[model samples]
Target: MSAKRGIELEPDLLDQRIKTLAELGDLTGDLVATASRLAERLPRLGTAPPAVHLALRLREAAGSSGLAGEVEATEREVREYKQMLSEAKRKYEEHESQAREDLRAAEESAATAGPDATGRPGSPRRSS
Candidate 1:
């Protein structure tokens, strides 16, 4: 492919990857916000004794034991989101590397096909 075409394609691929990373990052942020809200609310749930009592009773009826289990579950979800974020970052880096390679190859090919085939300044070719 021509250097211009390669440059165009690389940007398109990079753009797609950036969009995907942004989406994943947004999802991770939302999950973090949710976990934070839950943590904050978990403490406030203790301030109201009557509500706490009712919540405990409801937890017993629902077979959850207490709010701690829910908190743990949310914590696990947060961990999973972090893992996903790491994976997304790795994939982004890989995409960037591949795009760079593609662009470099295209540039090398273009340069080779141009007039300066030897790519060295002082070399002179023999007559045919």
Candidate 2:
């Protein structure tokens, strides 16, 4: 992919990217799950020293706006990117198939049509 040549989509590279995105999605999902479990299993800290307890800090680390939330967001983004890439691949394959079919049809048509079929100037005509 270069700026001067326009988008040169390499199928192998696209497939690799899709695979990487899937792997990242899985890793992020795992992280989110672990963080969620940590957040859920921890007991709420007592009110005496709300901001001073170690448990509170641990809970905050796994809080909704912390590690768990960030990982969840990453997982979602990866899933979305993978889906879009898959759709693009599907469309490209479909278009390639259609183009091949069209080319075959054109060749067949030309083979079946004799030279005089064009009726153009200087084209050989049927001999009576």
My TM-score estimates for the predictions, one after another, are 0.43, 0.72
- Residue pairs with clashing backbones, model 2: none
Residues 18-97 of candidate 2 have per-residue lDDT tens digits of 99999989998999999998877666566567644767778888877888898898899999999999899989989889
Model 2 alpha-carbon drift over 4 Å, by segment:
1-7, 41-58, 116-128
Indicate the TM-score of model 2: 0.72
Worst 10 residues of 1 by lDDT: 59-68
Q: Which ten residues in a row have the lowest lDDT in candidate 2?
A: 43-52
lDDT of 1 by residue, 1-128 (tens): 77756633344565566566667656665665555444444333564889788665654533333344455465566656656755666776789899999999978886777645646676555568
Pairs in steric clash, model 1: none
